[model samples]
Target: MHNRLHLTYANQSDQEYLSIYGKAKITENRQKVDDLWSSFLKVWFSGKDDPNLALLCVTIEDAYYWDQKNNKAVTIFKMAKAAITGEKSDTSDKGTLNI
Candidate 1:
């Protein structure tokens, strides 16, 4: 495990619309979510350099969106489990579990 990890949202030009919508902070928060996942991938796969252990990307749609960040966490956990146990992830309906 990494001793110290930093996460910050990287802003995009399109997010400027947030200001017009009075949702700048909300947009920034979503960027943080993306950053957190990116950071985790960096650490989780560090030093392994194994093609068999590559990380997979999972997409979550608004249809299942929730205020809590559990969606990402669940997807990550299920993927990890599937990799370790050599069984399909229970949380995902599709082969990759469209979280």
Candidate 2:
């Protein structure tokens, strides 16, 4: 179960939302609310029992990994450095994995 999902990481999959509680309840899992609860949330919700609180379930399938990869930050840095150094960047071995 997840709340306040800012983002999801899945390629080539359908998306769905499972509201834990009923439409009016807002939040079905009190433990999740407590677990993810924060003082900053008070600004959005009255409290843990706030009617607006809710949980969402995410499902992922058919995910694949890159065959080869470079550190994203390092890759960007290398690209930038290549521009200044006039040297080729080590940008190779990248593709969807078979398994």
**Best prediction by TM-score:** 2
Q: What lDDT would each prediction earn against the true structure?
A: 0.38, 0.54
- Model 2 alpha-carbon drift over 4 Å, by segment: 1-6, 9-27, 62-99
Per-prediction TM-score to the true structure, in the order listed = 0.23, 0.39
Instruction: Give a tens-digit lDDT track for model 1, residues 29-74.
Output: 4444444454456655553342434332322231221122236567
TM-score of decoy 2: 0.39
**Candidate with best lDDT:** 2
Can you write out model 2's per-residue Cα lDDT over 1-99, one digit (the tens) per residue? Answer: 433323324332222222222112233878897898899988888998877777765432223333224555666888899999999976544333232
**Candidate 2 accuracy as lDDT:** 0.54
Show the lowest summed lDDT stretch of 10 residues, model 2: 16-25
Cα-based lDDT at residue 39, candidate 2:
97
